[model samples]
Every structure is written in C-alpha cells, then in structure tokens.
Target: MKLLSFRVKKSHLLLVGILLVAANLRAPFTSLAPLLDAIRLDFSLSAVQAGLIQTLPLLAFALFSPLAGSIAVKYGIERVIFAALLLIAAGIGYRSYGGLFGVYGGTVLIGLGIAMGNVLLPSLLKRDFPQRVASMTGLYALIMGVGAALGSAAVVPLSQLSALGWNGALFAMLLFPLLAMAIWFPQLSHGAARLAIAGEPQQRSGSVWRAALAWQVTLFLGLNSLIYYVVVAWLPSILRYQGFSAEQAGSLHGVLQLATAVPGLFTGHLLARMKDQRAIAVTVSLLAAAGLLGLLALPAFATLWVVLFGIGAGSTIILGLAFIGLRSGTPAQAAALSGMAQCVGYLLAVGGPPGVGLLYDATHSWHGPLLICAALALVMALVGYLAGRDRCLTPAEPLNEGRLSEEER
Candidate 1:
C-alpha cells in the first residue's frame, strides 16, 4: 500500500513538472521581439541585422534538432531538459549585460536550450501519457503558447520597472526555469530507475526514414512554422507602419500569440473525434491567407485581420502537431518523425523572417514580402491536404483508415 501510494505521488509530481517545463519552452523565444526596436537603436543595428537577431533562435532550433534525439537517447530526456533549462537561465542572465558578441553568444545558448526542450517534450509526453497522447500534446502546446504570450506581453512593463531596465526584462525569464529546475530536481534523482524500467537499450527503426508520409508531414510542419515565425518576428513592424503606436503594435502581436493558445487547448479533442483533418487544415490555411491579404489590402483594419490570422495560424499549429503523433505508427516513430520534421522544417523556416526583412529592405515596401508569404500559405494548404489523409506514415498502410484510403492506394 505504501509503495502504491508513493507511485501515485510520483506520478502526480511528474505531471506537474512536465507542465512547468512545457510552460518555459517558448517564453525566451518570443519575449525579445517587443524590445527589438529598443535593442536595435541601442546597438545601432539595421532592420536586416535586427531581423537576423530574431532569426537566430529559429536557426539554432533547426541546426541542433537533429542531434537532440541522439542526446536524449544517451542522457535521458529528463536530464537533458533540466540541463537545458539551466542553460536557458544562464543565457538569459548573461545577455542582460553583454555587448554585441555576448548578446549573440547568449542568444545562441538560449536557442540551443530551447531546441533540446522542443525536440524532447513531445517524446516525453508520449512516454508519460501514451493513452492520452493527443490530449496531453494539446495541453502542452497550450501552455507553451501561454508562456509565449506572457513573455511578449511582459517585456515592456518589465523594462520600465524602476530598477529593471532592458537587462531586468531579459533576466526576468530566468525565474521560470529556476522554478522549473526546483520542481524537476526530484525526477532527476530517479532517472536511472526510470530508464531501467523503460529499458536503456536503444532500438533504431528503419521504416521511419523510408516513409513518404513522413516527408509530407515534415513539409507541412515546416511551411506552417515559416509562416508563424515570419509573423511573430515582423508583425509588430508591419503594424507600426500602419500608424499604430508602438505599444499598440506590440499588443497586437501579443494578441496573435495569445490567440494561438485557444486552438492548442481544443486541437487534440478535435483530432481525436475527426479522422480526416484535411478539410479543417484547408479551411485554416485559407483563413490565414485571408488574414494576410486583409492586412495588406486593408491596413486600417489591422486588428480584425490580426485576430483572424492568429486563429487560423494557431489552429494550423495544433493540427500540424497532431500529425506528429497521428501519422506515426508508434511512439518511437513519432519521436523520430518529430526530430526529422523539426530539424528539416525549421531549417526551412529559419529563412522566412530574415528573408522577408531583406525583401522589405530592398523593395522598400511590404507588398512583395506579404505576397511571398501568401504563396507559402497556399503551399502549406496543398501539403497539409496530402498529409492530413488518415493513414499511418509507414508505406505499408493504405489510405482507407480515415479519408482517401482507396484513392491513395
């Protein structure tokens, strides 16, 4: 009875720790945008250079993601996550005082930390909540979205506090990881025992690499991420040009981020209920396209379009994540697919924002860049359709499980 009770307690503790870890994943990435202009001015950076700064983390995520699986396999997910959080805290704290080199160095560290966390979390969710993978993934995404919104919303206020300054704003991020570390420490102590139960031996599956559905899912994920990050990095600037105050522009950006959380909360439930997620994906992509067009054609109504874009983008994000689990034949496949998707997709995505900024700088107008994004959205829709068909990523599975099964065969 005592042992059973202890097991229950450990499970509860583990859940809480996972939630906290999820909450910390996105804050560091999104929080810096609100302060970008201020930092740019202080450092005398051009728009392109500033955009590159914002692009660094995405680049890090892309570059480091492929290695995350190998690292997690050897070190254990919990240890890597905990260590990553500490690195994030250190990076955030260090950047508070550094010069340009220090800032970039620290940002790279933060990005690497986030990359490890991002690649591992879904696998962790799969391991911990295998029966409720979709639901737990939705919750995880929701918390991450909330964390991002909070980080973006808090930067200005944090910087304004009497003694805080910009450094204070950056340092504020350290608190979340520190708290998460405290909560996660106990789990690390039992890491070896858990590994033993789960088996420490690594088994590589050959099917994941040969799958066509895997590439489709990865492309869809990448395209969606490109669109999302482009907006996150530049939407405020776009709004600023539309004659809104800096604060209002930042608020709009924050609203878009906040809206992402809503779909995340419901996506798992929706995926579980409906096998064919293609129609939903197509509709959401159209909404995202409309929102972007709305911003371009009707800048005066930025708020409405931003909201539309947010909902559309947010929903698509949830759907893309759902594919990570739904399309994979097993948990290990899911993790492998996730690692492949994020690595390749994010590397593709890393170009979106900086590319947009460079185009904007050269063309001296937002129209060209906006149009390019719209085209990308169309591609996202097409790929999403191909990916959304109800079939496992393994080639042996036919399309008939959910939708277009007969046609696919």
Candidate 2:
C-alpha cells in the first residue's frame, strides 16, 4: 500500500517541479567555472580572490543550510522553495552586471537560495515519495548534472556573441530559476498540506548530530563535495595549463558533467537492491582516484580521465543522497540528517577550491594540487566505507540500529 501510494501518477507535476528545482541548484555555480579566468582578468583579481568567489556558495551552504529546515518548518517548504527560486533569480540577474560587489553579493544570494533547496529537497522527496527515495533522488540528481553541463557548455558560446558577452551569458541563466519558480508556484497553494507532508512530528528528533552513523554520512558527503567542487572550480584552469583552449576546456568540463548523469539512470535501482553499499563506494573512490592520477601523469588522455572522474563522482553523489534516505527512519529524520550532513559537510567543503588554488600558487604547478585531490579521494573512500554500512539512524536515537534494519530497508 505504501509503495502504491508512492507510485501514484497525480504527483507527476510535483516531481517535475522537484527536478526543475534541482536543475537550478548547480547551473548558477557551474556557469561561472568556464569563465573564471575571464572574470579574473576583467576584475584584476588575484588567484585567491577567484577561488574565494568559487568558495562563496559552499560557505553559504554551510551557514544557511541548517536554517533552511527551520524556516521551512515555520513558513512551509513550498513557500520557502518559492522564495528560494526568487532569490536565485534576483541574484543571477544582479550578478550579470560587472563589478566586485555584484559578483560577491549576487553569489551570496544564489548560494543562500541553493542552500535552502539543498536541505529541503531531500526531505521533500523522503516525505512524499517514501518508497521511491532512491529513484527520485537519482532523477533529480540526473537533472542537476544536465543543468550543470548545459551551463558550463553554453556559457562559452554565449559569451562569444557580440551582444551577450559574459554578462549577458550569465544573465541568461536566470531563465532556469525563473522557469522553476513558475512550475513551483502552484505548490504554494497547498502550503499547509506540504508542511504536513514534508516532515513528521515524532521524527523531529535532534539526535542525528550525535549519531556515529550520521557523522560518517556527513564526512562522506563533505569529502565528496570537496573533491567535486575543486574539480568544478579548477578543472578548466588545469586543462588550460595543459594546453587546451578556453572553449575546449569548457567543452571538456561539460563532457565531465554529462558523464555524471549516466550513473543516475540505474544507480537508484542498484542501491535499492544492495544489502550494503560499501563495494559501490569503494569502486567509485578508486575510479576517481585513478582518474586524478591519469590527469597528473597523462594529460594527453584528458578526456578519458575526465570521464572516469565524472562517473565516480556522479555515482557517489547518488549514493550520498540515497544514504540520507536509506539511513533514516522517517521523513523528519531525513530532513534533520540532510541538514546536519550538508551543513557540516559543506563547511568542510568550503576549503576545496581555495585550498587547491593556494597549493597551486605556492608550488607553481598542478602537481601539488592534483596530488592533494588524490589524497582526499582516498580519505573519501574510507569515509564512504563507514557511511555505506547497512545501518539505520532511528528517530531520536543516537546509535545506529542494525544491518539492513527493517526501519531503513
């Protein structure tokens, strides 16, 4: 019966809205990656400042994510989502204008908007699509990858147009959040129902922060974010140093993101059937690590390396998101876990881009930075092993219950 409820067709529109929201989450950030050098030159910014711009969103995610659920609880998730979309739209629009203030300020807004969506979307999925958490997460995650690809790919071409330039190219991204807002508006009509559907009173326990399992999940997520964002922020620069043109680098970055979407197609079902995800976790970790090693040793085969990294990173993302659902006993627990993981996880992630840039600046080569990433990938694998254990975070409970626990599976 619960499964059938999750399969109902009436909620299709809501699912579209959810995917659309996911789409907006990454486009605003990834669009800037391809143009980082251009923005840096135009603003006369230092390497550290450029990295700081890239780090702003992660910082926002860390600072604002915990508050998103509380705000949703008070204002309703749908209303909060509506506001977040507006915030993204406004931020992107303002950011299109050239200046340091416009850049940093708009980024802050975009980051804050995305942070709320980040914390709320998983909770929304768990609450409304309890039986379909993995599949639904995969679907949204796939859309996110697509949006990222489109953003990274299009920005280069769009900037070439005489009328658009980088500013217009950036302003063009506002279409996503604006379109998401249009689709999301109807959800606000059922605010009370959405509030009830998105969280449960009994599961609203504060115990997730203390659970060892939860910390493992949080570290897994944080390490993944650190690796992924470092790649996003600096991959183009690394490729450029390897002799790829800006357009070619951007195109390759797009390919990397497109590669990420592939695993989302089947990983959900795979995760659903697995008793424990440790094997899957280890495989992705090794794949990404190998890719990093390839980039450092054989820049000639950059495409292959990028694709491998993308697959591992993308698949791990689906697993990380699925863990939030798989490890929790209820929707509210999922929300709390999401908030806890993302807040602490993203806080740790804030160091990735800037750290890489700093390392590069100090050593004057990509070797040191790439080596650092490779090391982190190994750490990520260890964290993934812990997070992948078949256990459940019982509501209001500080300890993990059991392997393939009934409450979780």
lDDT of each: 0.78, 0.84
Please list all clashing residue pairs in model 1, or write none if there are none: 399-405, 400-405
Per-residue alpha-carbon lDDT of candidate 1 for residues 1-409, written as tens digits (9 for 90 to 100): 9999999999999888888888888898778877888788889999868877777888898898877766776666778889889889888877777877767878888989988887777767666776666677777788888887778778889998879877789889887789889999998876565553222333442345556777788888888898988887789888887788999997887688777788887777777777777888888888888899999999898888988888888888777777877786554556676778888878878877778888988988888877888888888899889888877755344232223445566
Give stretches of model 1 more than 4 Å off.
Answer: 1-5, 41-49, 194-209, 240-248, 395-408
Candidate 2, residue 9: Cα displacement in angstroms equals: 5.5
lDDT by residue (1-409, candidate 2, tens digit) is 8877865644877988999999998999879877888889889999879877887888899999877877777778889988999999989987889477889999999999999888888888887788888888888898898898788779999999999888899999998998898888878988887676565553444677778788888888888888987897789999999899999897888788788889888888888788688999888988888889999999999999999999998898898988898888776677788888899888877877777888888888998888888888898899889889877886644554323457555
Q: List the residue pairs that clash in candidate 2.
A: none
The lowest-lDDT stretch of 10 consecutive residues in candidate 2 is 396-405
**TM-score of every candidate relative to the true structure:** 0.88, 0.87
True-structure RMSD, every candidate: 3.4, 3.9
